[model samples]
Target chain A: MNVKDKYYQEVLRFWKDLTPNQRELVDHSIIKKHFNKGEAMRSSSDQCSGLFLIESGQVRAYIISENGKEITLYRLFDRDVCIFSASCIMKNISFDIFIETEKETTAYLIPTSIFDKLSKESMAVQVFANELMASRFSDVMWIMEQTLFMTLDKRLAIFLLEQSNIEESDTIKITHEKIANHLGSAREVITRMLKYFQEEGIISLSRGTIHIVNRKRLEQLTLY
Target chain B: MNVKDKYYQEVLRFWKDLTPNQRELVDHSIIKKHFNKGEAMRSSSDQCSGLFLIESGQVRAYIISENGKEITLYRLFDRDVCIFSASCIMKNISFDIFIETEKETTAYLIPTSIFDKLSKESMAVQVFANELMASRFSDVMWIMEQTLFMTLDKRLAIFLLEQSNIEESDTIKITHEKIANHLGSAREVITRMLKYFQEEGIISLSRGTIHIVNRKRLEQLTLY
Candidate 1:
């Protein structure tokens, strides 16, 4: 099968029980696009770009503050579906969110008009949309809980551990500025905390990278 | 019309274009209940309770931290619909949320089985459910933004102004502890901030009430 046919199969995986008419609608409406690393895929001010289903690589969804600080709401990887990019169809989601490619990525785009129509006509599509929405809400709520209730040190510790898990390496190749952006904190604050962690023999920091020296101590910090 | 019939009419306002079969299903399946102020309507550990449609009074949905601190996700007033109470049906919303009455409330509930069936059969019902979920996600995102990006003093000012608008009075009848709970901060932090605001002449505190003495300054504080 061609790449387009394979992508169509992937789409069907999400709505496996779609009726013949719904399947035809998706086949006619779906579009595929590729994004380079660090590319802006969607913006709050732009026209609603529609729902995106990641085929490969990853993308990050985040909100920017007035002073330009960014806090990631969540990240979508291969086989993940994103609804916030098409948030305009979802009534009352007024706040602006931006989606950017974290790595070279290819994704299927279902235009808002088609998805909206399909959702109105197909129960399967609607259920998928609601599940996607509910899951995103849970992600955002988790981030809010971390920001509100946890101290900066604990949050940093958690972030470091999470990055280690994601990279599958003790050495995480990320900058202090990037870490601050992820945690919605200042770079200097993150730098100071990293210094403290290093002093406490929890983690060692090198130029543009963080190495977990004491994974157990870092895990202990994340506990209440 | 009786109260139950009146609520049925209100439900129609949401799914106004429902077909006869859908209307009949809702009429027979909807359940009505009342909750006194401060009553616990639902908890994280309880079974799914389906969707809630508030007819009168108010309710708050929140998440509790491991250390027992509570952070409100959002609140529902008259005519508002709640989906988090039926989160189990959404498939991926695994977090625990608690719902409690903030005021004596009368509500209509569509049990999970019926709502699930209706949403599958009726496009109108599915549309209404998706809209309800989207609106709630937006509400939760707004709170997360405030918690992550805004300063506590600014958030407190915005909260006071919002309370004044809700009550249509300059004096807000709430305690520091309640404010802390809503903002997801320690009571001592809120108390200290309130004292600072009092010294700044933006507000005057008396007992459990806070009077906005300088509305202009308080509003200015919320501006970037």
Candidate 2:
């Protein structure tokens, strides 16, 4: 399906009770756009005036600390919007995110003005917001649960498994620096873990890639 | 103001945009109640059918792992809600949370049926959901930041500072066990650090209370 068809479905599922005219309005306002790997759709200090629904590839939303440390708030894949920043938009704060494409990525952005109109006039829009919030809460709770219940090694293994699930390759394409940023760890620590896991035959590493060798064992003990 | 009044004001801001009739509906439906320390609002496998918004005191929501470890997800103090169990309310899953009053706590419960209605019909309720999600995201971001940017001792220190903030006291009315649970660390480690901080004249301990002796220095450092 084309990108518009994807958002067409998202808007349908999002506002299930939307009147035909409202749904059509949403679809009409949404515009599909693409960005390359090195390009940004939204900068850290940009205005948050649109709803982004990803259709293809991936996007990374991260912040840099005052001391130049990077902290990744989200890694948006297909279907996950840059929704968390909507509060900043509502509060009139500068967007605290860097939404950069990890690859050639397509998304649909519906303007905030349109959303404001619908939210004021439409119950379906309210329900849509509720579902979006529910999903976001679920994502945050999972992160909290992982931090509380899983060890660093387990977290690494889970991340690797997730990467494998996303790509159809035993060898996933991502850098240690990127993984370090996402896990909020030093690159040195990630390299050490890669060596350790490789020695244990749990994984194999090549230049800029990691191949999962023991998926079952990785999942079994990764989050135990 | 009384605790109920404090909570009513908090909810008032969240429901500010609702029509008076809609606001009154929530007013009539929500019931404020109080619980003593150690009282359980819902235990493991119990039916969860409402959302509890904390007005006074503290609430600890934890789940028991397969290895019999109590994993604390989120701690709810005044102005917060135990939103981690919301899906259980929505999907009617037997509750995974064991929510207990950490002090003589007062809270209000909005029935799930009412919540579903408000979610569908009210912008005020939608804002509440968004704010809750934003707060949860902030919580996870804090944990992730601690995991990467701070040492174990630093994390414990920040936790203590946060606890002190919540209690609005120079002396923290909590034990090392509580600190360990909240920090996801060992009690032995917390004890060792507490002793060291005391020896360094950074803090003083008596019975179960931890007094901040070097508030200025503690603020400069990551430790509480």
User: Residue-wise lDDT of candidate 2 within B84-180, one digit each (tens)?
Assistant: 5455534212225577888999888877777767666766666666556556556555555565456676776777787788788888888888777
Residue-level lDDT of model 1, residues A1-224, one tens digit each, is 66765766675454566776877787788898999999888874565888888999889999998889999889998988878778777777777888999889999898999887877767777777877777887898788888877899999988998889878899999999999999998999999999999999998888998999999999999886
Model 1 lDDT per residue over B150-193, tens place: 89999999999998997789999999999999999899999999
lDDT of 2: 0.70
Candidate 2 per-residue lDDT, tens place, A113-181, comes to: 777677667755655655665564455456546645666798888889878887867889889987877
DockQ of candidate 2? 0.29
**Residue-level lDDT for A57 in candidate 1:** 86
lDDT of each: 0.84, 0.70
Which candidate tops DockQ?
A: 1
Model 2 ranges off by over 4 Å: A1-7, A10-28, A47-49, A62-74, A90-98, A214-224, B1-32, B53-55, B61-98, B121-123, B152-154, B165-168, B222-224
Clashing pairs in 1: none
